[model samples]
Target: MSILESLELALKNIVSSKTRTVLTMLGIIIGVAAVIVIVGLGNGLEQYVTDSFSDMGTNTLTVTVMSRGSTRTLSVDEMYEIVDENSQYLDLCSPTVTMPGYVKIGSETITSTSVQGVSEDYFSISGDTVASGRGLQYSDMAARGKVCVIGAYLNLAYYGGNAVGQTLRVGGQSLTIVGVLAQTDEDLEEGGSDDCIYLPYTTASRLIGDVSSYIITMQSEDYIDESVAVLESALYEVFASDDYYTVTSMSEMLETMTSMINILVGVLAGIAAISLVVGGIGIMNIMLVSVTERTREIGIRKSLGAKERYIMQQFVIEAACTSALGGIIGILLGDGLSIAASTVVTRLMEETLTVAPTLSAVALAFGISVGIGILFGYLPAKKAAGLNPIDALHYD
Candidate 1:
């Protein structure tokens, strides 16, 4: 028979036994859906990490100094001099001094607020803007002024949005709020990104020991490796050893996070693919039973001069069609689940993470399902083709 005629026959058989066909394809459906969902979740997580890194400035590098009993410590002026010398590679430098203390506003004492010492250039490097009043000035650092900038959370929650020129005590020292930063987060809550404070590094160092950390921005992100090498080399010369200081680039950290996510997704997808094999086995077993049930039909066709190749072609096509149908259903189910997962995650975690499945993943899954069907269907088709016409004809 022609291929089209055989395909028509295959469809009729599949339709006549609806329940059995669905049961056989269940494995393929579940496997494809599981793989797609897992891959989509991985994609969302990677995107979230990349976005978080981008907000923190990927062209920036963080340098931490650890005192290894060496009296030769790198001073803030020396650090600035290094950046000034390498003006082509480095653009901005700011010494970060974290002050440990609770913020006191009137009778309310808030310990959740983070107080840090930075420079006038720190706002530009961190992409923070002054919503009211003015940001830290160079004079503030020069004279060790006690002026500070407050985040939106403090401005709205404590000062009722007019925080500039307000007085707040940090580490028992009274500091005037010179500026209120523009809100970065959608919802301003306590201990969030919007709840923080910034002052001059000079003032903070006097209160909280010496400055041990610095944030430096590069002139160009395209030359991150060259810039990092120059910075590390300069720090090495200052301490005379690499053991006293460490330089880390945000771009390098982002790449490492993405690579780790990819590896995790690959392992999970591999595990979910095992179900496809189980589904294939189910198809094979069902096809073998089908061949036995249609023995009379096979015998009559063989007796009428039907070829063995034609019998094999019909059975193979039937299996492939069944698998293809299952794959289509699986793709639809996976897409629905992905959307639901995105919504549920967003509501529960309070973050917008979309679970989006890629087109390539869907296509590959469909192809694999069809391939499995053909592979498993071969043995049953072969057995049906090899049946003796005389014996099949006499058998009940």
Candidate 2:
């Protein structure tokens, strides 16, 4: 018989002991499944992080004014200098000033709505557009614009509905609400909506006692690195001290998330490796027992003139075939389980399960598991091959 045919016969013999074969395969099954699931989770975390950052929107950066003595060390002039120097370096720029107040209209009053004074270009930088009413115009901000933009939460809170074209009090000063912001969850979570109110920069300065707080945001598309460097240089020249006020690059969030993903992958791989080793040991134990049981058969074949090398090859092939079969099934099971788990997680959280184990992961896991089986199975095969025909055949 051809060597392959002999191996196939050995596999058939193994299959005759169906329960034993299945029990043996179980180790490989568990090992492969663990690898796939852990690897899949690692991939999932990476995608989830990326999605969160993308939702934050395009090349965005924030500059904040930090001051020790509350006499307003950083003025609007500094904001102008930063913006003017770096406007070409970015897509959009804005300054943010915040105040806390109640919005009062006749008998209706909404408390704890955040009020913000932002440049007219804040909407463009934030990728937000008004759902209704007009946003802050350049003309409006220049006149210390009393005109304002309202977020959806404001509509729900003060107006009990749409408050477009309605008048609200800022520091008890009447200001016309010119626009309502679009209802995007991200926008609301951000300072623009459910959490806060928005007003033109000039009007906010008028309402709050002339304190311009922070140089907030700039946006860009390409060459973000170059833009960040230039902006940093310009801001340094303006502030001259890192402690005075700081500019934070949006890329920090991305970098942190990516680092977290790499760490997770490493941790998962380590955990999965333990399971694989356990599986390998199980295979070895089973093969050793099989060799012991087949000792008499090895002696009988040897007595009939089978060479030691042939006997060794036969047993080794048997062990390898057993492992290869187990690896195949285990791999399929692992991948299937990973996909199912991902689906369930998505349904429960209402978030996409964005990571999938690449084909390389499956191939590598299965191949390694099979290789381990052969490696571990070698000792038992060797013991069977070295059996003395006389003693082995004479055994009961």
Candidate 3:
């Protein structure tokens, strides 16, 4: 018989026993859906991580100095000098001083605001743009000016979006807001990315303590390794030991996070694929039962000069058709679940992460399902083909 005739026969058989066919395909359906959803979640997570790292400037490096009881210390000026000397690799440098205290804006005392002391170049390095007024300048840092820049949340919440020239108190020190940053996040809520304060490192040092952490940007991310090496060598010379100082690259961290996500997705997908095997076995079992039930038909066809190959072909086609149908249903179900998952995650986590299954994943899932059907169907098909016509004819 032709392949099309075999397929038609397979469909008729599947339709005639709808409940049994569905039961046999259940494993394939569940396995395909599970793998697709897991992979989609992984993709969304990786994108989220990449975006977060990008906001922090993936080309930048964060350095922390411990000094470790050593008398030698690196000053902000020395650090700038090192960057200036290695101008080819390093671009901008900023001393970061994290201040601890509640911010008092008028009568309101906000405890969630992040107040930091940074240089004029800090805004450039961090990719933060000033939306109103002017940013911190070299003159402000030189004279330890009390001027500061505010994020969008603080600007709109307290100053009604006119934060420039307004004053807020941090640790009892009044700082005039010189600029308002452009909104970085979609929603401006309290304690979010848009709620922040930035002042000159010199003024912050005077109020708090000396700066021990610095953020430096590379001229190009392509030369990250070289930039890190140069910066590390300079820091090593200052501390006289690697233990006294540490440098961390944001790009490297991003890569590590992506790799971890891929590995996790792979493992979860592999585990979910086990169901496909179970489903294949189910199909094989059902096909064997089918062959037994149709023994009289097989015997009559064989007695009428039907070939063994034709008998085997019909059974194999039936199994493949069943699996292919299940795979199509699984693809539809997986897509629906992915969309639902995206919405649920967004509402629960308060973040917009899209769960999108790739075309390759769907195609691969379908291919594997069909392949499994053929593989498992072969033994049953062989047994049916090898049945003795005389015995089958008289048995039932």
Top TM-score prediction, candidate number:
1
* Local accuracy of candidate 2 as per-residue lDDT tens digits, 1-396: 469877887888788988888887777778777877778877887888777777665467766665557553666666676666676766555667777667676876766677888888788767777888788877887787666787787776567767887887877878888888878663333344454567877777766655534434444456667776776676566556667665666567687778988787878777776777777787789888887888889889999988887877777777777778877887788788888888888888767774477788888888887788778878887888899999989877
- TM-score of every prediction relative to native: 0.97, 0.83, 0.95
Off by over 4 Å in 3: none
The clash count for each model shown is 0, 2, 0
Error of 3 at 221 (Å): 1.2
Cα lDDT tens digits for candidate 1, 1-396: 999998899999999999999999999999999888888999999999999999999999999997656578888899999999999999999999998869899999999999999999999999999999999999999999999999999999999998888899999889999999999999999999999999999999999898999999999999899898998898887778998898999999999999999999999999999999999999999999999999999999999999999999999999998888888888899899999999999999999999988999989999999999999999999998999999989979
Cα-based lDDT for every prediction: 0.93, 0.74, 0.93
- The Cα error of candidate 3 at residue 195, in Å, is 0.9
Better of 2 and 3 by TM-score: 3
Q: Give candidate 3's TM-score.
A: 0.95
Question: What TM-score does candidate 2 reach?
Answer: 0.83
